[model samples]
Target: MTTYLKDLTQSIGYLEAQVVSLLGAKNLASMRGKGKLNMLYDP
Candidate 1:
């Protein structure tokens, strides 16, 4: 059970990184560096 919990956390982190990279790539590709990917998170 402990191993399962650890794996779950790791998987969630990996998934979030993949999603963020994909979104950031698209944004960066379109803007060509006019804005930052982190801006998506900031208000």
Candidate 2:
């Protein structure tokens, strides 16, 4: 029972980290896209 609980907690932590990283990556991608747009539009 204790071992199972530990594994469950570990899995949840890993999932949370994965989600955070994915969000960060998406934000970074959008930022890069905006930079590209600025470069194209700016005089």
Candidate 3:
């Protein structure tokens, strides 16, 4: 039972890392567009 719990925790951690990586990629794309817009307006 303890080993099962440990395996479950590791699986959850792996899923969380995948979610974070996906979000980071999306955020980077959004930020790149926003940065260009800001430069255009602020310059």
- Per-candidate RMSD, Å: 5.1, 6.4, 5.0
Position 12, candidate 1: lDDT: 100
Error of 2 at 15 (Å): 1.0
Full-model lDDT, candidate 2: 0.87
- TM-score, each model? 0.65, 0.66, 0.78
Alpha-carbon lDDT, every model: 0.85, 0.87, 0.86
What is the TM-score (0 to 1) of candidate 1?
A: 0.65
Task: Give the number of the best model, judged by TM-score.
Answer: 3
Clashing pairs in 1: none
Question: Ten residues in a row with the worst lDDT in model 3?
Answer: 34-43
Can you tell me which runs of candidate 2 are displaced by over 4 Å? 36-43
Question: What ranges in model 1 sit over 4 Å off?
Answer: 33-43
Residue-by-residue lDDT tens digits, candidate 1, 1-43: 9999999999999999999999989877776665676667656
Q: List, residue by residue over 1-43, the lDDT tens digit for candidate 3.
A: 9999999999999999999999989877887878876545553
TM-score rank order = 3, 2, 1
